[model samples]
Structures are given as C-alpha cells and as structure tokens.
Target: MVKKKKGRSVKKNPNVNLESEELTQAPHSFIIQRGLGHGHIVELTRDFRKLMEPFTAKSLQEHKKNTIKDFVSVAGLLHVTHLCIFSQTEVGMYFKVGRLPKGPTLTFKVQNFSLAKDVVSSLKKQLVVEKAFKRSPLIVLNSFNSDTAHMKLMASMFQNMFPKINLTNVDLNNIRRCVLLNYNPATDLIDFRHYVIKIVPVGVSKGVKKVIQGKIPDLSKCNDISEFFTRAAILSESEMEDDPNSHITVNQKLVSRGNVEQGQSAIKLTELGPRMTLQLMKVEDGLLDGIVLYHHHIHKSEEEKLEIQKKRDSKRKLKEKRKQVQEANKKRKEAEREESKQKSLKGMPKSTVDKDSVEERDDDVQYYREEVGAEPDKDLFLDNNQTKNDVSKVLRKFKKKKNENFCKNKEDKFERNKQKFGVKRTTQFKQNKSRVRNRLVGKTFNKKSNVKRKSK
Candidate 1:
C-alpha cells in the first residue's frame, strides 16, 4: 500500500474516540459570536406512515371511541343558499342557513365579531365562486328598504362586484317615462298649432342644472298633459292642413225681379169662415161614410144587460154568504171554548175546606150545642158566610192542592212503571199515556150515577 498523509489519515477516521485526549478545546467562534443564535437550517425527520397509522385501521376499537358529539348531515350545499342573521348579542351571534322549499335549516352560533365576520366573508366568497363556476344567473330582490338613495348605492356596489352580470331593479318594467305636453288654457278649444315640442334622448339630460335644482312636481295636477300632446300630434300633420287645391267657393246673382200679379189672392179672416164651414161638412160626410161601411156592427141587447145585472147580484150574495159562514164559525169556536172551561171547572172542588176552617167549624158546633143545651140547626151550622175574597182564596188553595196531588201521582206512576218498561221510555209512550188518562177522566164524569128514589 502507498503511504498516505497524516492529515488525510486523521480525516478519514473522523469517528475515532477524542475523550481520551487530555487537551482542552475552545467553543466554535461562530457560536460564541452569535451568543446561542442558530442558523436558519431546518431538520425534518417525519414518518408519514407512522403519523397516519391510527387512521389506517378502520375497525380499531380505540379509534372508534372518539365519537362525533353534535353533527348535522348536510343534504346539499347548493340548497343552503340563504344566510340570515337573526340575532347578535353579547353571548353569541345567531344565524340561519336555509333556502326556499324550506328544507333542513342549520342554525349556527358564532362566538365573536371577528369570527362572525370571517365566516360571513367566507360564505359570500363561496357563494360567488359557486355562481361563477356554475354560470348561473343571480336575481337580487329587495323590499325591506324603501329609500331610493340607499337602493342606488346598493345597486352600484353589486354592479362593481358582478361586472359581467346584468343588474336591474325588481320594478324596472314598472318605471315609465311620462312626457307632459305644454297646454294653452287661453283658448277654449285645444290649440295644436302652438304646442311646445320636446324630444329628449334616452339617458341624456335636457338641462342638468335645472333638473338638479328643480323639485319633482306633483303629477296629479298634470291631467291635461295627455290630451294636449295627443291633439297637438294629430293636428300638426298634412291631414289637418288647409289646401287651396281642395277649396271651393260659389257666387250667384238674381236674374230678374219677380212681379206680384193679382191672379192669386192672399188669405183673409173673412175666408176662414167659409173654410170652417167646408171642414165641418167634410167631417159630417166622413162620419156618414163610416156608418154606412160598418152597417153590420152589433150593440148590446136588453136581455144581455139584464143577465149581467143578475151575475153581479149573484156575486154579491156569494160574498155575503161567505161572511155569514165565517161569523158562524167564530161564534161556534167561542161556544166551544166556553164549554171547555165549564168542563174543566166541573171536576174541581166547589168549596175548599182549609184545616183551620174545619177546626173552627167543629169548635163552633160543639160550643153552640153545649151553651144552648139543644142541638143547633143543621142548615145554619153548615152554612158559612162566603164573600168574593173568600171564594178567590178557596180557589187558589184548591188549585195548589190539586197541582201537588197531580205531580205526586205522576212521579209515583213513573217510578212504578220505570222498571217494567226497560231502561228508558220513549216520548211516544209518555204522550199516549197522557192522552189515555185524559180520555178516561173525561168519560168518568160523563157516566150517570144511580140514586134510590125515596117514598113520598
């Protein structure tokens, strides 16, 4: 082998142990001068395979432990087109992400102003990018704000952002250019000859200074504008122009003076007397002619007149008969009512005997017999002094007692027959029972009672 240099030999085996040497070594001049400053050198010892190892195992139990807490499944990103900010408070800002047809709406709560701003900016950028990439037309409609100046400002901003797209107002079609025609009120008729004509180019100002300084006049006061403009336009053309070629004029002179001859006579008052006589003769002649032409005309005979009188008399008699029948029916109804009252009263007690009256009568009879030491007359004892007030009081008491007895009997019958009839009784059964009871009571009073005749 060739002999190598000592320096080369030492450099070739640079990994040789140096701790065994006793000589002290000084720090590097670069490190001392920079005072712990390191050069801009980066070291990368990344193992991408080792980093992604946890995500590689799909069925790993430990990885599955990291569950999603609050997750919302987005059906489609395009459908989430509307972003509405509902509220902004100290705690957080609330907003909804939704669209028409009202599908799933996602509400987001952003914590800070900076974060909300960033999120809104990102959303706008995404929307713009999506619109551009898809090449879809966008229509912006605003109805919440009515200020025209604010609307114009918004329109300018939108135009600046979407330079390639067409921007128009929602009511663009409704905007109209109304040209008010000048009117001359001095003339009663519409004067078309002196109309002030104006032709304004689209998007060009006639007088910019005047427009800026002038106020918008009320259109309600300009009713004659349409009529004036129409009349002016129609009458300004050749159709209304006077033409000498179509004009015609005539002139005439009398040939001769007519002579007044004495052949024809003028009408006089004296002639009217003979004319009236002739007219009277003509009227009489006309009447005679009419009578002769209609000779077969018939006239009413005496027998026919008599027959008409008889028919009138018969109609009067029929009306009187009908009135008499109606009167008889009314009287019969009154008599039937009286009879019904009498029948109803016949069943009621004639004289009511109250408990106090009965006791007083008994005490009076006993006192009279004891004091007189003889039996009192039966007729005098039985007869009590009766007055109109006493009769009314007796009637009232009798009515009350009858009503109480009737109600008690009705309730007792209903209770007794309620079980015999099933669980319920129909209205027909109750009505039939009432009708049968009324008929039986009416028949009971009609029966004649047997009485033994005493020997005279």
Candidate 2:
C-alpha cells in the first residue's frame, strides 16, 4: 500500500477584493443565437458581433445543446455584463437585450432587417477592410430623451453597454465608426444604422481628389498630365458634385488626410448595414422574467395593478422565508458533522480512551465497569502473549484430524444402492473420448481407466 503525503491547507478570503477598476467597470457582451437561426439571421448575428468589436466573443462557437446556465457559469469570470440573444419563431424574429446575473430584459420585434452584404452589393463603391472596428463604436442615441421610466432605463442601459468614454483623453482618429439608434415616436420604432465615418475635402473634383490621393490619372489618351485635366469633351465621371450639407470645418487634426485643421471637410457616411427596424414589444425584470416593467400591447386597471403588487410581495416574502430555512439547515448539518468528527477522533485507537478499548475495540466493557461502579477483578482484555498462544492452539485443534465416519459411509452407501436395486454393477464400453477426438489426440482404448471395479 502506498502512503499519502499531507499537503498544506489553504483557505481563500472572500471579503478581500483584488480586481482592477477597468475589468469591473468595462462592458463586455456575448451575442448568441438560440433555437433555429439560419441564412440572413446567422449573417446578421456576425454583423452585430462586428459592431460590438473588441469586447465581444469574436470566435465564440455556441452549441445547440448549450443552455442559459452554460453562459452564466462563465459570465462572472469573464466580466461579461450583457447578453444579446437572437431567436426566431413562427410569429417573427425577436431580439432580446438582457443584463447579466440579474436583468430588466428588453424584447424587440424585428420588423425588418438588411444584411451587410446586401448593403455593400447595392453601393457602387464602399470601403470594406477599414480598421474602424478595432475599437468600440461610438453610440448615438437620438430622440431617446423620453420622460417615461422605461424609456430612461433603456437609454441608460444602452449607454452602459459601451465603455464610458473620456471626452478629454479621447483620440479623434479612433472614432471611425458610429452606431445610431433613432427612435421615431410616431411609429414607436427604433431605426438602427452602422456607418463608417469618412472625411472628403469640400469643392474638390473627383479627378483632382484622385490625383491628390496618389492615384495616377489616365494620361495614355492625353499628351501630358495637364491635357488630361484640360479635355472638355473628355468629361470624366469625377465631375459629379457632392452634398453641400455634409461639408463641415475640421476642429482638430485627424489621422486620415483631406481633413486639414481650420479647413472645410465634408463628412461622409458609408452605411455598413445589418440594419434593423425594431419595434418595442415588452420589457421585463430579471432576465426575460420575474416582473413586467412595460408592455406595449397590454394595459391594466388600477385594481389589477394593486393585485399584482400584492402577489409580488407575497412571492418575495415566501422566497425570503425559504432562503432562511435552507441556510439554517446547512448550518445545522455542518455543526452535526463537526460534532461526529470530534467524537470519532476522541474514540480513536491512539486517543485518551481506555487501554481495554484500544486493545479489544469494544465499548461494552467500559459500560460494564461503570455499571458495577468499580474496575472488575479480571480484565476484560486478554494479554498479547496469552492471546497469541490461544489463537495458535485453536488453529492446531481445527487441523488435527478428519472424521472417520465420512470415509466409511461412502462405500456403505454405494453397496446399499446396488443391493436395493438388485442390479449388477458391470463395466460397459463407457468411452469418455469420441473416436475422432481420440484419433486427433493420439489416445488408445488399451490405456488404463482411472475408475476401479469393486473386488468380489
């Protein structure tokens, strides 16, 4: 038997906090698809992940068998704060935005959606590999300053989904992408749009812009570079004018050229779609459940509200009572376990228990001595030397002899059987081995049989 080496026991202190502020405060999300999602829905999920950028699980592969608990199990370890779950049903597509651990879940019915590929296909020219998604996108919430509790709560929740931007230290060059959530009060819908921010110089012809951007103009048809610009009939596609409303004067220097300080720069938005037209359906407390905070389709009377409040109160009270009971039961079991452990330790062979108990390991002797109110004349325990001698004597007695009656009865029983039946016990051709088997094994019939005939 191998002996086990005892190692040092270490206990962790729960109260001592060691996490940094950035990890605790920064918002991280997991965007997942539940149920059956395919085709455009899967592409749309990928687009949404791109929009979330660096803080999200980019390469996360979710299994169909994964439940909510699987994600929740690691949420705390990863400091994930939000869950964006997309699921499809017979009714339509649904989008759920839930806060982790506990939540006031927001459910939106996707009225319509357009994938990023569809947008790129529709556009004549658009930048695809721009490093805009390296950092988080700038969140722009428009017309969300509503006075209602749910509206304010939603606005706040959206704000918290991204890291709190420091205006003073923020780099102007890093803000390359923007996410717009425009709420239309008239339709009760939110228009979601993602765009790549570009700055083009104002009043510059596309030809001149191309030349300045290091693109060699088509001078093969012209004698010189000046003639390429001089040809009146050779009006290139570059002469088309741009939107005047987009022209804005640059306040700061940028990493991308054409946006000079104190110079006019036309801000352009190339829509990087996976666009969604979402209508608010419902909002509930504690992760898609627990309590209904708001409902667009449902309305209730004052009496109904009061009844709901009472029921909620009753449920809370019952939950608290159950929690208390469970805690008490756990403590009681722990105490009982500790007490039994101590008792077993005290009654151990090497412990302060009596010598008789250590030798024989029986508690009855101790009780007998207590009952008599004195130590008995004879010890209940046998000495080591005497006990060894007694054990050897018993073993020798058991090994001494076999019963003579057993051998005598065997022959008597065989003879009685032959006399009772009145039949002759004759040896016949009782071949134990088959002819084929005997030939294969090289055996002969003349060989002596182990069985002996009875003497006359």
Q: Tens digits of per-residue lDDT for model 1 on 1-456?
A: 999756646656766554332111111000001111122100000111111111121122222232211011221212222222123345533333222223223333322222212333443222112111122122233331435442333333222221133244222121111111122223211110101111111221223212333535333534664543333333334324233343322121212112122221111011000000000001101211211111112445678757866886798899999999999999999999999999988875545645556778789999998899988885554434555557788899999999999999998887778767743565558766776787787843223333558999
TM-score of 1: 0.14
TM values, all candidates: 0.14, 0.70
RMSD, model 2, all Cα superposed? Answer: 10.6
List candidate 1 segments past 4 Å from native. 1-299, 342-347, 350-456
Model 1 lDDT on a 0 to 1 scale: 0.33
Worst 10 residues of 2 by lDDT: 424-433
Residue 117 lDDT (model 1): 24
Q: Indicate the TM-score of model 2.
A: 0.70
Question: Per-residue lDDT of 1-456 in model 2, one digit per residue for the tens?
Answer: 999987654435554456678657789999999867765778888889988987899888899889988998899988899999988887789999999989989999999999988987888787775588887888999999899988998898888888888987787788888889999999999999988888777766555676767787877888887776656666545545567777788778887755678888777788988899998888888886777878899988888888998999999999999999999999999999999999988775644344754556345567768898877556455556567888998887766533456667887887787677544432122243454467688865544644578999
- Please give the RMSD to the true structure for each candidate, in Å: 53.1, 10.6
